[model samples]
Target: MFKTSLDKFTSINRIAVISDSALGFGSPDIIGLADGLCAHFGAKGILVQPDDLNRPLVDINFTADVRSVRLFSDLPTYTRSWRWNFFRLAARAVDEFKPDIVVVVGPNGYGASRALRHRPKLLVYYMLEMATTEPLYADLHKHYGNADIDAYIIPDIERHNIDFGNLHWRKDVDFEGIYLTAPINYPVPIKPRAADDRNGKSIYFGHIHPEETLLDNMLTPQLNDCEIEFFGRIGDADRGVIANRIASTPGKAYRGLQTPEDLADTLPRFNFSLVTWKPEGHIGRFHLPATKLYHSVLAGVPIIAVPNPLNVYFIRKLGIGLLMDGWSRRSFIESIQAAKAMIGSDAYRSMVDRCRVAAEGEFAWSRQVSRCAALVERALEKKWRRLYGPRKSQPALAANG
Candidate 1:
C-alpha cells in the first residue's frame, strides 16, 4: 500500500523555506541544507523570513536563483502585531512563489502553517527538537499536533518517533527519516600537530554568556594548560567576567564572530572544538544537538564535550570526538591529558579519518536534502492518491539516512 500510494506522482520541483528571524536566523547547517535541496532537486527555492534589513541574512547560505522575501520591519513585540505581520508576510511569499512544498523551520512556521491552511501545497516541518519527557517538549508537541504539516525532516535521528506523552496518538504527520547535521561538502584536511597540541589550545565557537560556569572554571590556575579560543557574541552581563577570564588565560583569545564560510578553513587550525553544558543543569532537558558539534565535525576537528546523553550519542556514533566526565577542574585536566595522549597516536589519526568519512556520508547536507526531496515526492504522491486516486508514475523510492 505504501509503494502503491507513492507511485501516484513524480517529484518535487519547487520548495519554499520559511524561518523566523526572531529566533536568530537559524543555524548555517540548516541554511546549507536548504541550498543543497534547491540544487539537488533542481527545485526553485523561495525563502521568507522576518527581516532586520540592516544585516545580510545571517547564518544562511542562499544561492542566486533562490528568491528571498523578507518583511521589511522589526518583529513586533506585541503578540497580535507579531501574528499579523507573520501572516501577512507568509501570504505574500505564497502568492509570489506559489511553491509546491513549503519548508517551515522551527516554531516560526506556526503562523505560516495557519496562513497556508487552505492551500494545496504540502507543508514540511523541518524540526530541530524532539518532544521527549520535558515539559518544553510537550509544549512543542502541542504546537506540531495542531499544525497542518505533511512531513518532518528532523536533524537528530535518536530523537525521532519517541513517545511524546499524549501527543503520540496523532498519526497525521508522517515521520520521514531525513536528517542533517552540517553541510560536509568536502573533507577538511587535518593539519599535523605536536603531541601536546590538545593541552590548552582548544576552540570554543558559540554563544559566550554568563552562567557558563565551565568557561569560568577553565580560568583556574590548575586549568591553565588548556586555554580556549572563544568566537561568538559575549553576553552583556558577562562582559567583565569574560574579560577577566581571557586576561588570566594568557594564550586564550576572544576572536569575536567568524562567518560560517570561513569555519571549515579556520577550525582545522585548532586542536579541538569545545562543547560543554552546565553540569546537571537545566540544559539537560532538551534533546537538540548543539550547532557547534556539526561545525567541528565538518571541519575535521574533533569535539571535547561534557558527557550528556545526546552528546555521548553523537560522539560515540561517529567515533569522531572525546567526551569529558564533567565540568570539574579534575575532569577538564584529565580529559585534556587524554587528548594530549591521543594526538599523533594512530587512534587519533583514525578518529580524524572517521570524522571525514562521517561528514561526507552521514552528515553531508546534500545527501540529507536528497533524502528529504525523496520524502517530499513520496508524501505528496500519497496525499494526492488519497484525494484523487492513484495515477500512473515511476516506482516509489527511499533514501538511507
Candidate 2:
C-alpha cells in the first residue's frame, strides 16, 4: 500500500547491498533498520542475501515494500565460491539495481571493479570479520581499488587499524559506527520466570560453527562453582567439541537457539549474558557484533563481552556493558564471577538501567537512521546536483545507461 501510494513519484535512488542475512542468533534486526530507513528516506533498499535455506533467517515485519537484491545469503555458499558466482552477481546488480551506493560485505569481492566501473557511485563495504584477517591481500586490493567504489563501514575498525597496521591502506573506513537494525521501541517482555530468573547460572547464546575453534578453546576448561548454561545449536565439529567439554558439568546444557522475541523474556532471567569466549588475533578479537549485545543493552541485562576493538570502542563510547580480555579460562571464570557478583549488587542493576535508557534515547532505529540518509546523500551527491536541482543530482549511476 505504501509503495502503491508513492507510484506517482519517480523511482528514488536505490542501494544495492551484498551481505549474508545470517540470522546469527535469529534476529532479523538489520532488515528492520533497512525497511525503516527506506520508508523514512523515500529511497529503495535492496538487501542482497536474506533468501537462504539457513534457519531463522532475518524474519522481520517490513512495510509493503521491502526487498534484498541477493547474491548468496548463505555464508557457506558465499565462502565456497567467493571467487566465482558472487562477482558475476555483484556486477549484474550494478547494472540492475541502478543504485546510488553499492554496499558489499567483504572478505574481498572479485567483481567489485566490474560493478563500479564507469559508475559515479559509492561502494560501502562492511568489514566486519574479513577486513582484519583475510590472507589474500592481492584480491582485496583488487576489490578496494577505485573503480566503482567509494566508502567503508566496519564493525572492527580499531583492530583493523592496529592488527593490519592499516585498514585497506589506512583508507577512510567508517568505524565512527553502524547501528543495529532494531525497532526504536520494543514491547516490554513478560516478566521473567522466577524459576529461570536466578544468578545461580550463566547463559551463553549463539551458534557453534567449527571454524570458531578460537572460541571453543577459550571457554571450555573452567570447572567452577558458577553454573553455565548454553543455548543455540552447534554444527558437528562444535557439537563434538562443545558436548565433550560440558559432559561432566551438570549445570551446562544446550537449549538450542531461540527467537529474539523469546530472548526478550529469556535473557533477563539469566544472572548474566556471556558475550564471547575468544579474543585472539584480528578475527576473534575484532569481529564480534552479536545481536545479543543489542538485546542485552535494551533489556538492561548485564553482559560479558570480550575486549575486542569494537567492544572496547562500544564500551568507551556507550559506557554500557563490561568486558574481559584474553582467553584464559581464568579470565573467563573471573569475569563470570565478577558479573555474578555485580548482578547481585545494586550497582550492576543501576548500570543495566542506565544502558537501557541510552538505547531508548540514542540507538533506537527511528533515531539512528537520520544519519543514514546523509550517508545516502553523500553517495548520491553528484547525482542530486544534476537531477533534482543544484541539490538534487540523482546518484542512480545506471540511470542514463
lDDT of each: 0.64, 0.55
Off by over 4 Å in 1: 1-13, 22-26, 52-64, 75-84, 129-144, 157-169, 184-200, 279-286, 390-401
Return the TM-score for each candidate structure.
0.79, 0.72
Tell me the deviation in Å of residue 137 in model 2. 6.8
Candidate whose lDDT is highest: 1
Candidate 2 stretches with Cα past 4 Å from truth are 1-11, 21-30, 50-60, 69-76, 79-83, 108-113, 116-122, 136-138, 159-176, 181-200, 207-224, 235-238, 283-291, 312-321, 382-401
lDDT of 1 by residue, 16-82 (tens): 8886453232255455656667777787887777655434554334663476666666754435566
What is the overall TM-score of model 2 with all chains considered together? 0.72
TM-score computed on alpha carbons, candidate 1 = 0.79
lDDT of 2 at 128: 43
